[model samples]
Target: MADNASGDTAGDALPRERKPSNTALAKQRAHIENLMQNVDKPIELPQPGSKKPLLKPPPEIVLNVRGSSAGAGSSDFHTYRELRRKEHLRIKLMEAEAAEDAIGEEFNREREALKRQDEEKTAKNRAKRQKRNKAKQSAKKSKPAEKAALPVADE
Candidate 1:
């Protein structure tokens, strides 16, 4: 059993009644709908730019000097020095190439000497084999003579 505010007990088998007020319920529902209407939607993101925006000024050529060696040097003088350095490098490269050629000739001579030694070794081996073969043949021929000189004996 459940008790109402008046101290009267309601039957457990019976459902409790809540009086419905149409005006009040409708106003509450409208207030909720108004709150829903005021809710914020998600914001859209900005699109990517097609071209990059300029951020800083373009680079400029600036001459920096630290010591007395770097004095009022003109652009023409700089270019001339570069050309002279290149010419010197070319001369050094030619000298290096000549040295390389000389080394290559030395290697070629050594290779030829090794080839000649190999050929001589092979010829010596061939001659040794031929001599061994001749000695074997002579031994074979002497076997018949030894057999003929043996005395006959009864078994």
Candidate 2:
């Protein structure tokens, strides 16, 4: 039993064998080179009068200040710049107005809620005051009769 246990421990402690670093690196380099070769190869042209080729469409042309003026045959640089600046300012102004309107609507809703809460509190206080006043009036009526009887006794 001891011999079998020692052999099992030795087997468990043994290191696993791995491939050499140079061979592993060489295999990776070969795979990358194969990918590079395929990437540079041109696509075959489709035959005429058959199915159309599935090529990507050309990119859209973007017009900046120089491109726009040149395309439009206009020579004034400062006027173009001014027009672009005005368009940006107009967009910013519109965004600011929209933000202000949204904020105002939220504030109005909060204010109305607070106003309703205050009205409810005032109504409760008014009911309590009316109850106290009724109690005081009943007590006063009973006290005056007692006072009138006491004065006759004293005379």
Candidate 3:
């Protein structure tokens, strides 16, 4: 009993399961440390007077929309504004199509609901008409019998 109690205590003191260490996390930490060390060095730059300009001046820009020879030889370049305008128009077209589809679906649903309501109303009206006709026929049959009995009594 003492040995069993001691074994139980030992088992309780130790963890029931052990989790494995993640190697990916260690590799990521090492990479981050290496990047930090590499970026910690000071950078050297040339003096303003010691360095020369690397680029030349840009050429003048001229736009001709009348099929003139001024811009005839230049390569056609699509500007950012033109691209944005095209994208805007495409987005508008898509929005319009989506709106049209949604409206069409709503209209179809409403039409079906109205048709069902109309059918229900017509069924009720038919029932009322049949009841009225039956009442009128019973009244007509009773009146004819009463009239025949009165004539026989007079004779």
List TM-score per model, in order. 0.43, 0.40, 0.39
Best by TM-score: 1
Candidate 2: lDDT of 67?
52
Q: Candidate 1: misplaced stretches above 4 Å?
A: 1-76, 149-155
User: Please, what are the lDDT tens digits per residue for candidate 1 over residues 1-155?
Assistant: 34566566557557779865579888899877877897885445799885523333322653543466665656757866766776676667668778889999999999999999999999999999999999999999999989999988989
Per-residue lDDT for 19 in model 3?
Answer: 65
Residue 153 Cα positional deviation in candidate 1, in Å, after optimal superposition? 8.9
Task: Report lDDT (CA) for all predictions.
Answer: 0.76, 0.75, 0.73
After superposition, the stretches of candidate 3 with alpha carbons farther than 4 Å from their true spots are 1-80, 145-155
Candidate 1 positional error at 72, Å? 15
Give a tens-digit lDDT track for model 3, residues 12-75: 7777775655699977988678778889675566766833223323325535343655653433
For model 1, state the Cα shift of residue 45 in Å: 47
- Model 2 per-residue lDDT tens digits across residues 1-155: 89676677655778889865678778899877887889978666776774332333332663544654355545456667876676676667668778989999999999999999999999999999999999999889989888887855564
Clashes of each: 0, 0, 0
